[model samples]
Target: MTEPVLCPADPAPVTLIGPPLAPGPLVFLGDHAGALIPRSLGTLGVGEADRRRHIALDIGIGQLGRLLAEHFGATFVSQTYSRLVVDCNRAPFSPGAMPEVSDGTAIPGNTDLAETVRADRVAAIHEPYHQAIADLLAGRRAAGLPTILVALHSFTPVYAGKARPWQAGVIHGGPGSDYGRRVLAGLQGVQDLTVGDNLPYAFDDTDYTIPRHAFPNALQWLEIEIRQDLLGTPDQVAEVARWLAPVLRDAMEG
Candidate 1:
């Protein structure tokens, strides 16, 4: 398998596929899809070894987003820069903001960022991706469809020396609904698949994506995390999309 790139290019990295102004009842986001680092910022003091860590980007999510976009015909917006450059999933004020060190490598560039430089990142990259999201929501609302938010992500198989057994994790914001549960229930018994209602990282009101955007908009939300290895191939992505399509339809109708 080809190694995932550490980051993409600078100045509004990443790509938005499907429609930017679609009125689908669903919206898709891939926060850590980019693997490019900005030239000005450079790689955070982090070394080559650390950049490959889960800290960079959620591996395989780009593929999954493509599959999801095709399967659901939902507008998908994904990040193109490395998460080490700036965690797209994190709140702007959260300490993970511009992490100086990740996965045991000190990100040289991230240490002690100047106020102006930090704001540049927030404005140059972060704001545009989110604006795309806001536009999707606005379009959905305008069409009188109850929007359902689905954030695509992938996790490493092992972290910090501990083995992670979950093949997929389906996370819901604090707000529980049948949408989240029914999807989980549908994926009943795949071999070697251990599913977590919420695993690896949980969500919260203070610092998260689902609730921060979805709830306030009165949208249904489900955050899905596939083990990166499971989604490493195109076949895997297609299989997942095929499997989930009907399940999502059921959830929508339910």
Candidate 2:
């Protein structure tokens, strides 16, 4: 879907879908929970079939976000639009920020766009989400809560037909911290767990979430990745949540 339409019926669509439970050192965010292919955009060459791929959104981040929030008594923030419109994880400069192709699916709607159209995606989706995150972090800072930022995400097992073995990956931006170290240690006993420090992708300023917000302040944070197959369903989400809950508790307390 390359030909982008600047007007989406609803511009800013952020979904906070959980209780504002206890005040702990944890905050769960699903930067790509959105999967809405706005009605105005039409088909954009590829049909609804193509947009349903993992490239459009994190396969099961919404469920993961919810479980993490409830299990850890944390606040949750999620998006309600598809990443085919604009990727929340990517910095605005990254070409994939508004990708024309992801995995093997080509997004026809993202192809040709003038500055105004491009800016429209940013204004409608990116800015509002980032602003909300900023407000959350700011509030937590003022309230004296030890914030441990966790950006939940899921990755495809085979991209272009190659198998990926990492069941989970934790993206640690800074050198080291109690949060990152404890996370790695907690996950060590788990069988077949492939943990990547900067594996799939490293953190950079272009990453508006981790760098712009988490790293600059040296906040204890990690961008977590779970294999899509492992979390593509509700049962899967709950299982993964159980696997991660106690580890997160230790990180929050340690």
Candidate 3:
């Protein structure tokens, strides 16, 4: 049996914001918004430098998601724990969800983890964050409102010692690829940006959030990845948000 990873009074695994019934058709999610390890886990035995790396969180996505949500009055849901603890964007049972190593950095706490320990992280953090997304989407459906799910994320400017040139990526596959394409088209129109169709990474079975909530329901959706270097400052985040908000709005409207 999986032992309970959280004590009786841990903070909620998800942070839900914006009005539940916001007027827009958009719903935002930041699965890698936070980089906090539980007190009990104590940094998962990793160095401070690694803990603060892109493997821990999606860099500026939390603020970007919030700004988009606030701009559109859409519901925003984000995970509250670091992806190093348990990646909320990955399927609970997938290896990436509780990876022993990420982007070349080994996670000491995750090494040779017991099944129960892995299960506990899933139950404690991953499950609740996704459930909150489901609940919000269900409520929107119940209210007879249209929904367009947007999975917000950030990626390292360089990975595995290779420099990636794309400023951003729009990822989607299967029946949902059209919406992603529309978003990509809007982004491409921007001056001096090297946008990619699925550059940084593409969607696959390992992606839990969009596949679970957006794909099955036929909800129009897009999984967007912004370059982490572009989000190093609050002003930069705001600039990206400003640039993206209208593009998304235009895409959805068209």
User: Which regions in candidate 3 have their CA more than 4 angstroms from the true location?
Assistant: 1-4
Give the candidate order by descending lDDT.
3, 2, 1
Provide the overall lDDT of each model, using Cα atoms, as 2-decimal numbers.
Answer: 0.73, 0.75, 0.88
In the range 1-254, model 3's lDDT, one tens digit per residue, is 53357665667788988997887888899999988887778789899998888999999988998898889988889888899999988888788988999988899989988788888888889998988988898898999999888899999988888999999999978776677788999999998989988888988777888888987898888999999999999999999998898899889867
Better of 1 and 3 by lDDT: 3
Superposition error at 172 for model 3 (Å): 1.7
lDDT of 3 at 12: 78
**Candidate 1: C-alpha lDDT:** 0.73
User: Per-residue lDDT of 122-220 in model 1, one digit per residue for the tens?
Assistant: 776776677777776777677776677888888888888888887888876566445777777765544555887778756655345665678788667
lDDT of 3: 0.88
Candidate 2 lDDT (Cα, 0 to 1): 0.75
TM-score of 2: 0.89
Give the alpha carbon lDDT tens digit for every residue of 88-118 in model 2.
8788646878887777677778886666777
